[model samples]
Target: MSTTDVSTNDIVGAPVATTVEDVLSRFSGGNREDLIPILQAVQNSTGHLSRESVLAVARHLNLPPSKVYGVATFYNQFRFQPLGKYHIQVCRGTACHVKGSAAVLESLKRILKVEEGQTTKDKLFSLEVVACIGACGLAPVISINGEFHAGVAPDRVAGILNVYRRRAKNG
Candidate 1:
């Protein structure tokens, strides 16, 4: 696994949540204007924004939790839950849409039994739909932790998921 993959930190405990406090310290005395950067840093450190961390951030910034949530939810860049071991990003950009990526996305959702932006109960996978993956020529694409699967059709999603499932099982 790459060292920089934040998904490696998909740990459940106070330890992971505590990193938010460390990130908040960097923005000590900062105000609401610092909310975005603070959130980004926290997510970078903890891999997501948990309710505990969000409350801490609210306290640190002297703002309401609702305000912090408002900003985080407003932007697509923020994630409120830890990424699963496999982070699946489906492209829904113009080119991807034209190529029927939406069907591929729905296939994944149905098979995974989780909606977009959620991790599976096993914590093995999480789904995200991004505006673009920058592989326009490879429209209808999905990537697992930055490894692209190009020209994906709805039927292929299960096979792709099985590949990862087998890997996890074998290891």
Candidate 2:
């Protein structure tokens, strides 16, 4: 089924019958081993693990909702909230911190009006502060949808965000 056939209410409240059915049909076994893969598949398609989807998975696997939630939460890969079109990852490693990444992060938070790990109200941006991104030489770095912006300064935050905003509007 197409994404258009699925409603936002269904995604957030209860799993759509068609969507859940379609996702379940992909797997063959009811063994516990199927749990991670099933969750991964659902998250892959839906972008995040919604409560409804988790419940549907629990029912399908004859497991408890708590178990599903426990596993999902244990893993860093799973996300409950819907991500914005632009996902921003700010480096907070030692090198980044020493190079003013904190200021850059503050700038992001101020300009986006969202705390770390939160999405903007407009669904245009999501902010995440990571411990490290393996770009020590490029300390004070921020990545927008995986495109690294090295040596980011607080003053440049608006201009950088504007580039993405313009892209969204133009596209």
Candidate 3:
């Protein structure tokens, strides 16, 4: 066995069973063909493909780190960072853009102190810009974890965020 055969706890720097080692253990062999499936499995369990996890996978499969990272970056489905409790997706399609979604997105960034594709420091929110959410009628819309909010305005960003904050605090 290779040095990569170390325990999952040893590999992840955490005792969790969902580490790269745990995922790799479920598959046999180190064939190059297993790359995508391995990535998908790791991401499915971990919510995101962390840098350490990717490197661990490379070692496990005997592939270069660049090969793994190249494949992961080629796919939009892969995320480098873990998502926040509330994943915020802002629609920036043509209709939403015409309806002033850019201003709405700016407000969200300022209020959350996070740029697109980044989670807030408190881990309460993550922001993403999507081409569309299929809510053209509700232009300038954003969705919090798939729950759509329509007709969002720049000034209303604070009130909208406060609602989620209140719920989290109260709960």
Candidate 4:
């Protein structure tokens, strides 16, 4: 989205994204309690709800910026910035750990050439670590988006990443 679309009133000194007004318009005639939905709308527009977006939301709802920021930060899924298209999460639970999850993690870092929570320079992928995905049966599981990869070997990291690479290219 273009950055020119958002404007800030004198009350709040945050720069809203261009899509904030469209998001606000979705429930223009609704109740003020639609704060959560409003935030979600802003997040969808900008990938993450930025401080500016929250301020715009607060202004729209006639609520406090602190309150809007609090709610946005309280949710783990919400991000205050844009994220890459692909999200890769590796399982780090005991079962996976015993089965060489650390090696898997290391392999991923080497292959992707990025640290955990870091996105590839190309913006094609973002890597992260998860405690567990409850798929202990498949120890050392890795997830690309929501697709599960059980019984992952450090050797297979390249191939797995290649699958996403190919998919990204094809899509």
Residues forming the 10-long window of minimal summed lDDT in candidate 1 = 6-15
| Candidate 4 lDDT by residue in tens digits, 104-150 | 99999998898775678888877777787789999999877677899
lDDT of 2 at 20: 55
With a 3 Å backbone cut-off (N, CA, C), the pairs that clash in candidate 2 are none
Ranking by lDDT: 1, 3, 2, 4
Q: Which residues of candidate 2, in runs, are more than 4 Å off?
A: 1-23
Error of 3 at 35 (Å): 3.0
Q: Which stretches of candidate 1 lie over 4 Å from their true place?
A: 1-18
Candidate with the larger TM-score of 1 and 4 = 1
**Local distance difference test scores for all models:** 0.81, 0.78, 0.79, 0.74
Candidate 1, residues 1-171, lDDT tens digits: the string is 222233433222112544776777778876887787777768777777889988988999889999999989998767777788888888899999999998999999999999887889999998888887689999888988778999999999999999999999998
Model 2 agreement with the true structure over 1-171: per-residue lDDT tens digits = 332333332222223334655777777576677887777667666666888999989988999999999999887556677678888888899999999999999899988898876789999987777778788999888888778999898999999999999999999
- Candidate with top lDDT is 1
Q: Each model's TM-score?
A: 0.87, 0.74, 0.77, 0.60
- Across 1-171, the per-residue lDDT of candidate 3 in tens digits comes to 232232332112122347678888877788788788778777767767899989988998898999999999898656677778777888899999999999999999988888776788898887878787688999989988667899999999899889999999998
Error of 3 at 74 (Å): 4.0
Candidate 4 Cα misplacement greater than 4 A, ranges: 1-81
